[model samples]
Target chain A: MPAVIPTDSVGLVHPQTVDFPEPLTLECGRSLPGYTLAYETYGTLNAARSNAILVCHALSGDHHAAGYHSVDDRKPGWWETMIGPGKPIDSNRFFIVCSNFIGSCRGSTGPASIDPATGEPWGLNFPMVTVRDWVRTQAALADRLGIAQWAAVVGGSLGGMQVLEWAMLYPERLRHAVVIAAAPRLTAQNIAFNEVCRQAIMTDPDFHEGRYYAHGTKPRRGLALARMIGHITYLSDDAMRAKFGRDTRNGKAFSFGFDVDFEVESYLRYQGSRFVEQFDANSYLYITKALDYFDPAAAYGGDLAAAFAPIRASVLVISFSTDWRFSPERSREIVQALYRAGREVAYAEIEAAHGHDSFLLPVPQYLAVMSAYLERIAQESGR
Target chain B: MPAVIPTDSVGLVHPQTVDFPEPLTLECGRSLPGYTLAYETYGTLNAARSNAILVCHALSGDHHAAGYHSVDDRKPGWWETMIGPGKPIDSNRFFIVCSNFIGSCRGSTGPASIDPATGEPWGLNFPMVTVRDWVRTQAALADRLGIAQWAAVVGGSLGGMQVLEWAMLYPERLRHAVVIAAAPRLTAQNIAFNEVCRQAIMTDPDFHEGRYYAHGTKPRRGLALARMIGHITYLSDDAMRAKFGRDTRNGKAFSFGFDVDFEVESYLRYQGSRFVEQFDANSYLYITKALDYFDPAAAYGGDLAAAFAPIRASVLVISFSTDWRFSPERSREIVQALYRAGREVAYAEIEAAHGHDSFLLPVPQYLAVMSAYLERIAQESGR
Candidate 1:
C-alpha cells in the first residue's frame, strides 16, 4: 500500500479556474467556441504521476470537494468528511482533482456565464451538455494537468454518471472507477422528478425565459421550491422521521395557518432558501436535463452490458439501502452488467438511513469500505 | 337487504348549495360566521332516511362526484367510475351524497367566496379548517338534509381522513366508515411533500398573499408547478415506467432543448396546467393544512388505539401496495389500531401499480373488494 502522508499537510485549499480556448463539440451535436472550468486540487502528485485520483461531484456540488474555501467558512467543502489527509479518498498519498461541471454556476461556464457574441449571460442560448460532454471536458482538464491516466475516478449520483462515462468513453484514461448511489440510466420516475423541478424554475415569472440576469433578478422562489423538492428525496422516511417526526416548529400545537408549522417544513424551507443563494436556476435546468438525457445503453443499442464490454477499469459500485432516488436495485443493474462484461468489480450495499445523500455523509461503514478499496488501488498501482 | 334502485335513476346530476346562517366553530379555534356547501345527490333517500351514504372527496375533488353537470361537459365527475349506478358504491342501493368541502372553490364558500362584511373575496382572511372541522360541518349538512343517520361515510386519501374523523367524532352518525389509502396521521415525509407544494404556490408573486382574486391575475404557474409535483407522487414507479418509459414526446431522440422532451414530462405539464383552470390556490393551501393537521392520535395523546376505541362504526381499510405517499405500512397503522381498539374492521392490501391515486382509479380488484364490503354494509343496515 502507498504510505499515508502526514495529516499536518492537509488544510484549507483555494479554487482555480482553467480556460480551454479550443472549441469543443457536445453530444447534442453543438459546438462551444471556448469554456472555462473551476477546479480545486489537494495533496501532491507523486513522482510517477500514477497516483492521481479524479473526484466528480453530484448536482448542486462544486469544485470545493475538500478543505475550507476560507478560514471562517460556516461549513467546509462538501466532501471534507472523506477527502482530508488519511480520510477515505485520502489526499495523503494520491493527488485529487475536483471540478465544477461545464453547465454549473460555481465559477464555471454555464447559462450564467457571459456570452462572447452578445456580452450577456449565455442564459437559454447555452448548448445542452450531456454526461459524455462533461467527462470529455474533464479528460481535457486532466491532459492540461499533465496526468496521462488517473489511478481512480470516483463520484456519486450525477457525478457517478460521469465516472461510468469515463470508464466507457476513455477506458485507458482511468484504472479504477467508483460509482456510488447512481443508476446506469435514469428511470422514468427519475426523469419525471427532474421534469417537475425544471418546470418549477422555468415557470417562475422572474426566470424571464432563463434571461433573469438581464432583468437584474433571480428566480429565487422557483429555485428554492426545486431545492425543497430535492431535499425531500435526498432523505429517507426513517431519517426524516428521526429528525423532525411531525414536531411543531415552535410549540406543541399546530399553528393552524400557512406558517411553517412543522419542524420538517421549516427545515425544508431553510434548505430551499439557502440553496437559491448559491445555485443558478438555469444551471439547474441544464444539469437536470443532462441527467435525464443520460442513457449509455441507448448509445449501445439498448444493451447496457455492451456499453461496459470495452471497459478496462476495475469498478466499485456502492448503494445505500434507503436511497429511493437511485435504489439498490438500480445499482445492481450496473453491477450485473459489469459482471456480464467480465469486468473486475466490487459491490457494497451500505446500510444507511440518510438516503441518496449517504454517499456524501460520514457513514462509518461507507467510509471504511471506500477507504479499503482505495488502499487496494494504491497497492495495485505500486504507489 | 334494501332493493337496488333503477340504474336509469343515477346519471348526470346538478349541484345544490346549502347556506348555513349560524356560525360554525373550527377545530383550530376559529369561527366562520356562516358558510355554504355545494353538494350533489345520487339515487333517492329511503323513506326512513336511514339509507343515506355520505361520500367525502379528496384534495382537488368537489361535489360533482359521479356525473356531468351539463351534457357538454368535457368529463364526468372525478370519481364517476366508482360511485354511479351498478358501480362499486352502487348509488342504486345507497343514496349517495357528495359535497364540496368548505375550503374548496367549486361553488362552495371558500377563499373565492365574497365576505358579506367586507364585500370582497375572503382570500387569506378565511379561517383555517381541520379534518375534524370539515366532518362536523358535514354532520350539520346531514342534519339540515333531514337525514337522522348515515348508513355509511366513505372517502379516500384526504377524504379518508375525514372518514376516520367521522368514525371518531360522530361515531353515532355513521354506521359504517371506509377509509382508503390513508394513515393514522401524516408522517414527516408526508408533511414535507405537502410543505413543498404549499411553498410553490405561496412563493409565486402572482399569489399576492392569496389575494390573487383582487389582483385580477392568478398564480397559475405556481399552482401548475404544485400540481406537477403532486402528479408525480400520485403515480408509482412501475406505473410511470409502464405508461411513459423513456419515450420522448413526438420523437425518438431527445429534442436537445427544454421542450417537454419526455412523454411523462408532457403528461405532468398537462396535469399541472389543466388543474389550475379548475382549482383555487388558496384552497390548495387550506386543504393541505387540514391534511397536515389531521392527527387524531395526537389529539388522543399519541395512542392510536385509544383514538379509535370509542368509535362505534364498523371500519373498512384499503391500501395499495405501491402507494409511497401513504404506504401500506401507514395504512397498517390504522388497521392495527382499529384491531387493538376492538372495532369490527376489514383490511385489504390491493396489488397495484398506481400510487396514492390507486384509490381514485378504477382498479378491478380494488373496486371488487369495495363492492363486496358495501354489499355487506347494505345487508346489515337493511338499506
Candidate 2:
C-alpha cells in the first residue's frame, strides 16, 4: 500500500491518483474493471488518523477544493474562501481530502477515459453511477489512507447529496456530516432543466452520438448553451438586477442586430464560452443523470425518515434563501426527515442573494455559521 | 378602402390581408418598403364603429384569436376560450380584431417574407420593431377599416405591452386598456432568459447567420431547444410539479440511457419539436429582441408614472400568483404608475397555478373579473 503523502506547501495542494484493483459494481448492475480516483489532500492526518475530513465537490467541481493548483493560476480552488490554513474548514487543524468523482472529466476515470476493451473513449459506454456508489468509493479511498474513521464529511450541492449518502450508508465511518444547498430529490422542474441541457448536447451535430472524441471534435455550441442556461438559474433575480440591470454593453443603444446587447447577455455568453474549455459534454450528461436518479426515499419505500433512521452522524444542512433551484423548503424536507428519525440535525436557511451558487460564494454570515459548526464538531470529536 | 366584411357563421373568423403601398417607418428609423397586415375580426361593427375592440396576441400567437380557420381544424384559435359568443370578451356584444404582428411568421411581413429587392427571404434584414411600432401599424389598420377608435384594447404578456403602449401613444384612439401578465420593462432576469434562448438558436450551425431558408434547411434543433427553455419559463414550478412530479415515462424505472424518462422531459421535448413546425427562427430572434428592448419607462427616464400621464384610457391590469416570469410585483409596477397618474385603473392578482399562461386559460375567476370589467366599459360607452 502507498503511504499517505503530506504536502508542505502553504496554500497549494497537489492531486494524487489511486488505483483500485477490484472491479466496482455500479448501481446499474454494470461493473467497471479496475478504476482510478484522482484526489487532493491538505494539511496532515493526526497520529490517531481521526482528524481527517472528506470534502465532496459539486457537478462542475473537481479535486482542487482549497488551494491553487499552480502558482500562477488565474483563480484559486472553487471553495478557496472556506478552506486553507485559517479558513472555516481550517486545513492547519484537520486533514482534508477532495476527489474528482468517477464520472468527471477532471483527472478521473470518466467518459473521456479510454476503454481498454475497445481502445476508445468510454463515452456512453461508461456505467451509470449513483450517490451511494460515490460514497462507497470515497470510503474505499479513506480505508487505503489508514483512517479508521473521518471526523467529518462536508459538501455542497451534488457534493451535499454525497454527504447525505455517506451519513446514511456508512454511519460509523464519519462523526459529522454537512450538507449544503441540496435537495432530498430533484423536483420535476429540476429534472426538466437537466433534460433540456441533455437535449441541447445530444442534438448538436458535433456531438456525434457521444463519440466526438474519436472525430477530434466537441459539441462546443451545445455545451455552451447548456452552461448559459445553468448560469441563469444559478443567479437570483435580485442579484442579476443588481449586477447587470438594463445596462447595455459598451454603453450603446440597441444595435437592432443579433449582437450581445445587455450586460447580462454578455456575462452569460462568457460563462458558456469559458465552460466549454474546461468541461466535457458526456461527463455532464452522466453526472446530471446521477443527480436526477438520486431519490433516497425510493429505496426506503418512499419514507425519507426511514432512510435517515440509521444515520448516526451529527448532520448540518444549510440552504440559501434565494436558491430557487434547490429552495430552502427542500432543505427543510431533509432536516424534518432527520428530526423524524430521531437524529441530531442542525439546519440554517441563510439569507442570500446569489441563488444556488451562494454556497460557493463568501457570504459573511454563511462563513461564520460554517466556522461555528466545524468548531462544535471538533470539540465533540476531541480533535 | 375595403368594406367591413362581417361573417354570418358564428365563432368563425377569416383573416384579411391589406397591403400598404407606401413605406412604413419603424421605431429604429428603418423603413419597410411595403408591408401587409393579416387580421381577423369577429362579431359585427356597430353603425357608429364605437363597439370595435382590438385583441392583441402574445409571442407565438397569431391573428386567429377566435374560431377555427376550417371546420376540420384540430385546435381553435389561441384565445378562443375567452373570445367567442357569450364568452368573457363576448363576440356577440363586441367587435374583436386580432392581427398578426409585423414581425410574426403567420401571414405577416416578417423575416420569412420575401424582400422584393433581393428576391429572397428578408432573414436578418427585417427592421427591428418596438411595442410602439406595432400600435402605430394597428392604428393605420383601424384607419383603413373606418374604425376611428377602439372600444377596448386588450392583451396579455407581450400583447399587454402593446396595450399599454396604445394607452400612452394613442389614448384618444382606445377607450379601455386591459394589460395582463406584463411588466413596465424587461428585468435583467427576463433579458437573461431571452438571451439564452437566442444563443441556443444563433449558435446552431444550421442557422447559417439566420439565412437558413436560403440554405434549404432550418435550425430545428436550436429552435427546439429555445422553445423548450421558453416552455419551462412559461409554466410555474407549482404547475410543473402538479403536472409531472418525477413521473417517469412508460411506467419504468430509470432507463440508464439518454432516452426521455421523466414525463416533464417528454413534454418539453414535444413542445420543442412541435414549435419548430409552426414558428420561424429569424422571426423568433427579431421578436425576442423586441421584447428585450421594450422599456416604456426608459423613455420617460424610468418614471413609470410619467409614461402613463398622457393615458386617457381606463386601465385594467391583471397578474397571476404563480407567474414567476412576470410576477405579480411586475404587474403592480404598472398599476401603481397608473394610480400615480390619477388614471382609472383596476388591479387584480388572480390566484393561478398556470404561471404566465394563466391569462389565456379558462380560469373561472379570471373570466368573471374580465367579464364584469368589460360590462362596466360597455355601460360607460353606451354601445
Candidate 3:
C-alpha cells in the first residue's frame, strides 16, 4: 500500500513495552512473576501527566489502536477511523496509551509468551486472566508511564469491559469512563456462542490441547471457524444484507456442490481464513473465558447497582441500535445500575447498522457524541 | 421406557417407505435415478380422500413427525406436543403424511443413501436438492398415496419453506398453506450463519471430502460443532436467558480452562454430542445448501410480491415474537406478497418466547390459531 495517511490520521507510530518485576496477582488466584505489557503512545502526556487517555481494545485487538505501523502496512490499526489527530478521540489533544491485554499474542505476556522458568512458550501453562486482571495491568502501565490518573479510559465491545473495570477497580485512576457497546456480563446466549467458538478451536486435532506451539502446526481451520462465528455476530443483519445480500461470487449461479454459493458465505470464509493468519487459538480461549467471567455484580448478590460501589469516574455508555451481540439493552443495564448506585453516568444509543462493530466505525452521530463528551471533559476537568 | 403414551396421543406408529423408480431431475442439472421416501401416517384418509395434510420437516428433521415409535420409546416425535388426537394438528381430524425430505438423513434419498449403480453411498455425489425439488417429490408421494391434492401443506422453519414452495411450485396441489416462522428468502446474515456451520463440517479432517463413510468414521467433532452453532441460532436471546441464564453447570465455579463452565455451555455441548450420534455430516451440507437456495423472489426479479404470482393456496402464516432466526417481519413479507397477488392470506404473530421452535410447541394461542385455521379449511372446503 502507498503512503496515503490522511491529514487527520495519527500517522506513523511505534509500539513500546513496559516491564514490571513485581508479581501480578490474578482474579483466578494465580500470579505472573515479572510480566511485560506492550503499548503504543500517541500525542504527548501533559506536564502533569493527567491528560493521558487509556485506550483499551476488544477481543483480538492489539496495542496499535491507530496510525500506520509502517508505510507498507496495508491497513492502519483497528479503530483508526475513531482515533486520529482531529478525530473523536483527538490524539492531538490527549495522550493516548493503547496496550495489548495480558492474554494477547501481541508482544504481551500471554499463552504464546515464553515462561521464564522453562524458557518455553507458556501455552496452557499461562494463568487465567480476567477483565479486572487486565485493568490491574493497565494501571501498572499507567504507573510506569508516571500518569497517576487518566483524563479518560475508553474502549468498545470487550475493551469497554475494561473501561468499566477501571471504574470499578481503580476508580480514582480515571476521570471519565467511556464504555461503548459493552455488557456488564455475558448472557446465556452470549456464553453459548463463546462456548461454541471455543469448541471449534478445542475440537480440532491440530489444537493439541492449546500446546500447538510445540507441535509447530496450529489449528487453522478451528481458529478460522471460531473467527467466522464471531464475525457473523459482529455484523448486524442489515449490514450483511447491504454488503453481500444473496449475490454470488463473480455473479456465478449456484455451483450445486458444497462450494461457496452466496457472496455472504464467500465473505465469511475469506474473513475466517484471514483471521488465522494473525490470531492465536490459545489466546482466543483465554479471552473468551475472561468475557464469561466478567460479571462483577455476581459478588454483590447479583446486584449490579450494588457492584457500582467502587465507581468514582463519570461513565459514558454508548450503544448501537443494531448491535445484537451487545445490544442497546445491555448498555441500558449498565446505565440503570450506575444510576441506581447514584454514580454519574451518560448514555447515547447511536443508530447504526454495523452492529457491535459500529463502535470502531466513524458513524457521524457517534463521532459527534464522543467529540462533545471528550471536549467537555477537557474543558471542565482540565488535566 | 414403558408405554406411557398420553390419552390424546397418536400412540405407537410405524414408518413406511415409498419407492419411486423414475429419474428425479434437480434444478442443479443433476438427477436421482430413483429414490425412496420414508413417512408415517396418523389418521386414516376419508372416503373423499380430501382430509390429507402433508406435514414437512425442517433441516435435520425426519419422517417421525408425531406419535411414539414403540411402546418402549422414551419420547414421541419432535412435534409431539402439537400433533395428536386432540392437539392443534388434531391427528383424528386430518390424515397427516409426515415424510422425510429428499436430502435429509432419515429414511429418504439423501447423500447417505446407497447408489444403485455404484452399490455405495452417494455421499458427495448426491444431486443438490432445493425447496422446489422437495415439493416436487412431495407431489409424487401424494400421487402414490392416492391423494390428488392435499387439504393443507403445513411446516415451520425450513419445513415452512417447503409449505411456501408447495404454494409457489405446485399452486394447485394444495388448498391451504400453513407456513410458520419461515422467511420468504434467507437474508445475507442467515446465509452467513449457514455457511459457517457448513464450513465446520466440511473442514473436519474426518469429513474425507463428504465421503466420511469410506473412512469408517465420521467427522463427529465437525458435525457436533455445527450442531452447537445451529442450536444457538435456533433460540432467541430471551429464550436462552430464561432457560439457562449464566448459571454454571451444577453451580460449580469456573475451572479457568477450556472446559464447560456455564450451564448454557453444558447444554449446548450435550446437544452437539447427541446430534453427532444421529445426523450425517454430508446430509447437513445438503440441508443447509437447500436453505441457502430458498429465495424464490430471486427468480421474480427479487420481488417477493411478484414471486407470490404462483401461490394460489389460501395461506395462513404464523410467526413467534422472539424467532430472530426467521423473525415475525419475514412472515409479514409473505403476507404482504400474498396480498399483492390477490391471494387469500391470514397472518398471526404468536406472542411466545420459544422463538423459532415456538411453532413446534403447544403455546395456547399458537395452538388456538392453528386449530381455528385448520377448522376453517376443513369445514368450508370439504370434499
Candidate 4:
C-alpha cells in the first residue's frame, strides 16, 4: 500500500481557539454546548474600542484574514488578496476580528468537533445553526474582547448574511454595516445550490450518514465534488473562458477520450482535491444549510422593512452586477427595505465581470468603493 | 450494503443493438476492426428515402428518443419533448434514426462495452473517440439502412455538434442541417465547464483510475456532482430564480443546517441523482472531451467559411438568446460561415429565457421557426 502522504500543510498554517462552555441555544430551537470559536485578530484594538471591526467570513472562509502564519509558508488566508495591512479592510487602521463560524471545520465547533458525551465527533448530532446563532456567537466574542461597539460589521455572500444578522440582532454594536454581494434572504436559487451540494456530500457511499471517520474513509470525494460545483458558481463564464480555454493538455492532440483534455479540468481537479485535505464533508452540509435558512425578513413578518426598523447604523450595501448567486437585484431589495425603515443606507451595484467573487478580488472599483465607505464611516464616528 | 437504486425506471427498459462495423482509423493513428453501433429507429422509412432524418443525441443521450415502455413508466427519453408522432421532427412524415454515439454507454462501443478478446467490459481500455468517430458511425448506419441521403440532420447542444459534423463530413448525404444552441468550436468557457465535470468524475476515490466496476463503486456521486454542474449551465439564472426562487420542500422555513433549502437545490439534486443511474462517469469524461475538442473551423483552417465550403446542405441555424453556454453570437458565426460558403442558410436567434434548453421547450417562436424550416426542407425534397 502506498503510504498516505498527509497534506498536513493545510490547517496547520494557523492555530486559533476561543473557549465557551455549556449549551448555546440556537434560534432553531436546538441547543449546542461546548461552544468554542477559533479565530484570529489582526492590527490592534484602540483605547476607545471604537476602531474594532468584526469581519465575517464566507462559507469556506477562515480566521487567517491577513499576514503570514508561522506554521506554514502559504500566504495569510483565502482573502489575502483583499484584506492585508494596507488593503481595503486595512489591518493597519483597524482591529480586524475574524472568527470561524459555528459550523465551520476550521477549528470551530462543527460536525467534526468531538462530542463530550459520546467521545466521538458530533457528526450529524451537532445542533442545527442559523445565521442569528453565528452572529450571537460573534457578539459573545466581542463582549469578551471589551469591544462595546464596532467601527463596522462587514461580510460578503454567506458572510454578508451574517453582517445583515448583526445589524438586526445587535444594531447598537456597530456604527456601520457593509454587506457585500449578499442577500437578506436566500433566494430559491441560492437554496437550490446549497441543497445540491448537501445532497452531493450525503449521497457519497463513504459519507456513512456522517460517521465515516471511524472507518478511516473520509467522504473527501463528495466534499471535493461539492467544492467543484460551488467553484463554478463563484466564477463567471467569461472569466473561465479567459483563464482556461479549450487548450489540450501535454502538447498532444486530444486523445478523443476522457484524459483531462483541457487545462481547466486540471485546475478544477486540483481545487477540489486540495479542498478535502482540510474541510469536513458534514461541515459543508451544515454551513450550506445555515446559509439557506438565513432570512432576516422572515422574522419581521416577511417585511424586510420591519427587520431593519431597529437599526440605527449607517448601512453600506455593495453588490456586483455579475454576481448571479447574490445579484444586485437582491442588494436592491435590501436597499429598499432599509429605505422603508428610514435607516441611513448607501448602496452601490458595481459593474464587474468577476461575479460573486468580486468582493474578494482586488478589483480597483470595489476597493475604491470600500475605501471611501470606510473613510466616511471613520469620519462620522470621529475616529 | 444498501442496494443501488436504478434511476427513474429508464434502466428497466431493454435496449436493442444495431451492429455497425468498419475499418476504423483514428486521427491518433490507432486502428480497430469491427466497431459495433447500437441505435433505435422511430417512424417508418419512406420509399423515396427523402423522409429520412438523422437525430443526433447529446452527451448522455441514448437511442430511446420518445415514448415510455408500457412496463416501465420512465419518461420516454431526454429529447422526447422535441420528437414524436406529430412533433417537431414529425415521426409521421420523417423516419427518425437516433444512434447511441460511438463513445456513449448506451449500447455503444464505449468504456462499458465488452472487449471480445477478454470477454469483459473494456472499461478504461476503450479507445478514445471523437465527434468525427460518432459521425462516421452514424454515416455507416445510414448506409446499411439504405439511406443514400437524409432530408435533414437535427440536434441541439452536443447533439448540434454532431449535426454540424454530419454536414461537414458527408455533406452529400444531408439535404438540410439544423444546429441549435451549439457552437462551431468549443470556446475556452465550454472547455472549462466540461473539464470541471471530467475532474469530478476522475477524482472519485472509487473511480480507481477508471476501474471501479470491480469495487462495485461506479463513481456515482462524482458523476452526479458533474451533472449538477452541467444542469446549472443548461438554465439561465433568471430561469432558475423564476422556477425555484427559494421555494423549500417539506416546509417553508429554512432547516438552518446542511440540507435542501430552496426549490432550485431540490431540482438540481433530482437532476444529479437521476443522471448517475443511466449514465457512466467514464462516458461523461470521454463525451465531454469530444465536445471540448470539437472545432469545425479549426478542422478546416481558422476560417469557418472553409469548413462549410464542402457543405451543400441548406442550413437552419437556431440559437437561444439567453444561452450563455452557446450564446447567440456563436450561432451568428455559423450563419456567417454558411453564407460565405454560398449555401442556402436561414438563421434565427430566438428570444427565450430558458437558456440552451429553450430549443427543447415549447417556446412558440422557436417552434414556429423550426416548423417553417422543416416545411421548406420538406418542399425542397418534393415531399
Candidate 5:
C-alpha cells in the first residue's frame, strides 16, 4: 500500500492506454480479438500496488475522472468532488484509475469502431457486450498495470453494475466494493425506456439501417429525441418543478404557432442538441443493449447471494432518495444479497433530490461517509 | 318551451347550420366570407329554442357524441356515457349538438382541406388559429341551428376551453356551462409539452416542411415520437406503475439487444404507431398550438371574473382528483371566477385514478352527478 499522504508538485498527469481482449466470444460466434482501453490514472502506484481504486462511470461518462486539461477545456472530470486531494477516494492515499468502458463511444471500441475484417466502421455489426465482458476487460487492464488486487472498486448506476461484477468475478482481487444507485438486472421499466429510445433512433429515416454514415447522413434528430426522453427519466418530478415550473421561454402568451414555449423545452432541446456533437448514435444502441442484458445473479443459478459467495471485500453500498430510474429499493436489494452472502458491508441511502445523478452532486453527507470509509480502509491496509 | 313529457317518433330534432365570417381572415387571407356550419341535434328544440345543449370535443374528437353509425363499425362517439337516451345530457329532453372545430383534421376545414380559390390543400397556408377562433366558429354553427340560447354547453380539457370561450364570447347563447378538467390558459409546462410535439413534427425529414404529400413521404417517426411524449403526460406515475411495472414483453429475460424490454415500451410503440395512421402531423401542430395559446381570461384583461361578465349561464365545473395536467385547482380557479361574477354554479371534484383522461373513463360518480344536475335543470326549464 502507498503512504496515505500527498506531494505538493506532481503537476498534471496524462491519460494512457492498455490492450485487452474480449473475455467470451460474441453470441455471433466471433471473438473480438485484441482491443485498446483508454484510461487516466492519478496519484501514485505503491510497490505493493494494493492501494488501487477503480472508478466506473455512468452511461455517457468518460475516463476523465478528475482534473482539467489546458487543451481540452472541459470541466474537471465528472466526479471531482470525491476523487481529488484529501477527498473521499483521496489521490494521496490511492492510485485512482478510470477507464472508458469497451461499449462506450468515448475513445473505446464500440459500434462505431473500425472492423478489422471489413475495414470500415463496425456500425450495427458490432458484437453484443455484457457487463461481465466489461468487467473482464477491466480485469485485463488491472493485470497489465501489475495490480494483483485493489483496495476498493467504486461506481454508481451502470458503474455500480461493474462494481458488483468485480466482486463476483474476482472477489480475492478487491478489499472493498462500493455500489451506488444501481440494480441487479434490467427492470421492466428500465427496459421500456431503452426500447423507446432505440425505436426512435432506428425508425428515423436518416438512420438508414445504421448505415447512416455511408449515406453522408446522421440520425441527429433521432438521437436528440432519444436524449430528450432519457433526460426526463434522469430527473424527478419535484426536481423538474423546482427547476422549471410553468416558466415560459420567450413570452407569456402562446405564440399560436410552432416554437419553443417553456424554459424546460429550451433546456431539453439544448441537452439533446449538444449531446449529438460528441456522441455516436450507434454507440448508444450497443451500450443500451449491454445494460438491458446485465444480470449478475443469472449465472449463479438464480441465487444473487451465491453470486457474491467468493467476495472477500468489505462493501459500502449507497443509494439516492430520488433516483426513480435506479431507486433506493434497487440498492437495498444489492445490500440484502451481500448480507446474505456474509460479506462485510456498510449501507447508506443518501438524502438527495438529484435523482440518479445525486452521486455526482455536492452532498455533504455523501462526502463525510465516503471520507470516513476510505480513511478507515487505509488504516487497516497499513502502507 | 316544448312539452317536456311529449315527443313522439324522432327523439329530438333541431339540426342547423349558419354562416361565420368575422374578426381576421385565415392565413390564406381568403376571408371565410360565408362559412357553412354543420351540426347534429339530439332532443326536441323547445318552442323558444332555449332547450338546446352544446357538446364540445377534445383534440381528436368529433361531433358523434352517441350511438353507432348506421353503416359504419367505428363504435359510438368518443363520449357515450353522458350523451344517450337516458344519460346525463338526455336526448329525451335537451336538443344537443356537437360540431368538429376548424383546424381539425376531421371533417372540419383544416391544413388538409382544399383552399377555395387555389383548389389545393391549405397545408401551411392555413392561418394559425386561437382557441377563441374555434369558439367563434362553433357559435356560428349554433346560430344556424336556430338556437338562440343553449340549456348548457359541456366539455372536458380542451373541450372545457371551448366552454369557457363560449361564456366569454356568446354569453346569451347558453343558460349554463359545464367545464371539466381544464385551465383558463396554458401554463408554461403545458406549452412546453406542446412545443416538443410541434418540433418533433417539423424536424422530421420526411415532413418535407409540411409539403410531403407530393413526395409520398410522411413524418411518421416524428408524429410517433410526439404521440409517445404526449402519452407520458396523459398517464400518472401511479397508473404507469400499476399497469406496466417492470414487466417485460413476453419474456422473463432481456434479449440482450435493442428490442422492447418492458410492457410499457410495447404500449407506447403501439400508441405512437396507431396515432400516425389516423392523425395529420400538420393538424397536430395546429391543434396543439391552439391549446397552448388559449387564455380567455388574459384576453379579457387578466380578470377571469370580468371574462364571465357577459355570461348569463349558470355553470357546473367538474375535475378529477388525479388529473395532474389540469388539476382540480385549475377547475377551482374557473369556479371562483364565475362565483365572483355572480353566476349560479355547481362544482364537483370526483375521486379517480385515471388522471386528466378520467372524464373519458368509466366512473359511476361522474355519470350520477351529471344525471342529477341535468334532471334538476330539466325540471327548472319545464321543457
Candidate 6:
C-alpha cells in the first residue's frame, strides 16, 4: 500500500538537511563554524527554475507546511489548507520550500543543538541569532538549493519578518514578498509579553541557568507557564468566550479548589504541557529575543520608508482585524512604508475573531486574497 | 509638628477592626468560625445615618483608602487622588468606608491571617470566600459602625464587583451602586490568565503547596512573575507604547542577553519585586480564585436581568475606552441588563487610554461624571 494520499494534500513527504560547513557570522557579531537547516519541499521546478516559492515558518513552527510525513500521521502540517494542489500557494503551479528557522528547535540547529567544541548542547553559549542572522543562514541555504531568485517569499508572524528581511537584505532574490500578520517591530506591550515568557522559562529550577540539557531535565513548568501565557495572547477575548465562556470542567458546580475549574484553564494547561514536551526552553528564549530585536527601521534612523528603500520585491501584506498581537495597523504601517519607498504593495485586512492565530487558520477571506494575489504572481512568473 | 496636613485632605486616618465571632457561612458552603474585618472611615454620619457611602477596594487594595496613617507617610492612601475633602469622593460631604476584602492580605481575615484552630496562617485551608461573602462582611461592618443604609456604594474592578454584590445581597442597604471597569463575571480569557498566575505560584518550589508560610519561605519568583503579567494587563497597549516604546535601559544597543533589554521589562520587574514585598502569595491565589468564581447570573439560570431584578439601588456603570480587561462592552452589558430588570441605571464610557487602571486615574471626564452623580445623591439625601 503506497498509503492513499488525499487528493488535496501533497501527501507523504520527507525532510532534508543541508549543512553549511563554513563559518557564518551572525548579526550579534558572533560566528557559528557550521550549522544545518532542516527543510521540506513540495511541487516541481520549471525549466527556467523561476517557479519556486520560499515559505518561512513563524516562532515555534517547523519545515512541515503542507503534507503528512507518514500514512499514520494524525495531522497535516500547520498551513495545509493554504498550500495544497489547488490551494493558495498551489503546489501544482509552483515549487515550494519551507525550512525551520535557525533559532527554532524544530529539527534545526538551535540552542539545543550540540556544540562540537564542548560536546554539549549550546544553550546560552549559542550566539544570539537575530532575524537577520536567520535570513543570512536561509540565504546560504537558498544558494545551496540553487534558488537564485524566488518567484515569491511568503510567511506569517515571525516568518513574515523574514520575508521583510529578504526584501531588504537580498533585494533581487525574491520577486514577490508576502508578509502576513507581522509588525515592522514589536510594540512595548509585545516586548513585555515576550519578556514575561522569557522570565518564566529562565526562572524554572530545572532550567539550571540554561544548562538543563546536562542536568537530564527540562524547565517543563516554566516552559508550560510561558506557553499558557502565549496561548492567551494568540486568541481573542471573543474567541475564548465563545469557545469556553464560564463553562466548568466537571459540571455546573464551581471547583472552589485550585483544580481545573473552567474549560479554558484545562485547554491552556494541556497546551502548556504539550509544548514543554516538544519545545526547548533555550530556543524559546533565543527566538523571542529575535522577535523583540527585529526592527526594519532601526538601522535607518527610525524612518520606515528609508528602511524599505532597498526592497525590490513587490509586496503583499495581510492582517487580521482582532489580532492585537500584530494588529492591522502594523500591516498598514508596512504598506505605508512600501508606498513611501515607491514599492508596489498590496494589502488586505481580513475580518476574523481568531486574533493573532487567525494567520494560521484557513480563513475564507484570507485564503481568497492570498489565492488571488499569488495567482497573478504565478502567471507573471510563467509557472 | 503634625506633618502639615493639607486643608483639602482628610488629614489623618486610621484603620479599625470589627470582630465577628459567630460562624460566617461562605457561598462555597464552607464556614469561618470567627473573623475580623479591617476598615477605615472618614467624615461623620449625619443624624439620619443616611450620609454614609461604602467604598470597596479592589484586588491588592486595602482599608487604607485615603489620607495618611502616620505623620511622616511618604504617600497617602491608594485613592488619595479622588478621596480628599474636596475630591470627587468628597470626604467632606459623605461618610466613606473602605474595608479590605476577607480573602485579601491587607489587614483582613485572609489566607495570611492566623488560623485559630492550628495557630498557623490559614494557607490553603482558608475557606473559599466569594463576592457575596465579602458583601455580608461589609454589611456586618456597617452594623458595627451604626449605619443602617449607605447613600451609595462605589468601587472599581473587583471593588466594582463588590458594589454589584451589595446591590443584590442587600438591596435596601444601598440606595445607589457605582460600578467602574468591572464585568459581571470573569470571561474565559480572564480565568485563563488567573489560572496561569495560580499555576506559576503553585509550581514554584518555595510554594510548598501553599503552605509556604509554615515552610519559612515564599514563592517570590512565581509571585513576581504573576504580578509582572498582571501589570502588563493593567495598562492599555497605547499607554505602554507612549510610556516605553523600545526604549532600552542601556541606550539604543540591544542587550542581546536576557538581563533587561527594554525599559518596559525593567518597569515590570520593579513592580513585580515591589508587589512580592507587600503581598501574600496565598492571598493572591485565593483572591484570584474568587475573581474567577464570581458570576451574578450563575444563580439566576444565566439570566442577567433575573439576577438583577431584586436590586432596588440605582446603578451607575462606567467603563474606559481601552479597558480590554473589563471592556466598555461589558459595562454596556450591565446597563442593558439593568434596563431589562427595570432598574434605574446610568452609563458612561469615558475615553481614556489607561486600560483597566483607568478607573483608578483622575481622568477629567471620569471625575466629572463621579462628581456629578455623587452631587445629585448628596442633594437628594440632604447631607
lDDT string, candidate 5, A194-246, tens digits: 77678778987888888887888878887887787777778765577678765
DockQ score of the complex predicted as candidate 3 = 0.89
Give me the displacement of residue B141 in model 2, in angstroms: 0.9
Q: Per-residue CA lDDT of candidate 3, range B141-233, in tens?
A: 999999998999999899899999898888888999999999998999888888888899999999999888978989999999989988888
Residue B91 in model 4: shift from native, Å? 3.6
- Candidate 3 regions off by >4 Å? A381-383, B381-383
**Model 6 per-residue lDDT tens digits across residues A86-151:** 999999999999988787788889889999999999989999999999888888888988989999
Could you give the DockQ of candidate 1? 0.83
**Candidate 1 per-residue lDDT over residues B274-335, each given as its tens digit:** 99998999999999998888888886779999999889998999999999988999889999
Error of 2 at B92 (Å): 0.9
Please give the range of 10 consecutive residues that has the lowest summed lDDT in model 3 chain A: A374-383
lDDT of each: 0.89, 0.89, 0.89, 0.78, 0.77, 0.91
Fnat per predicted structure, each in turn: 0.93, 0.89, 0.91, 0.62, 0.35, 0.85
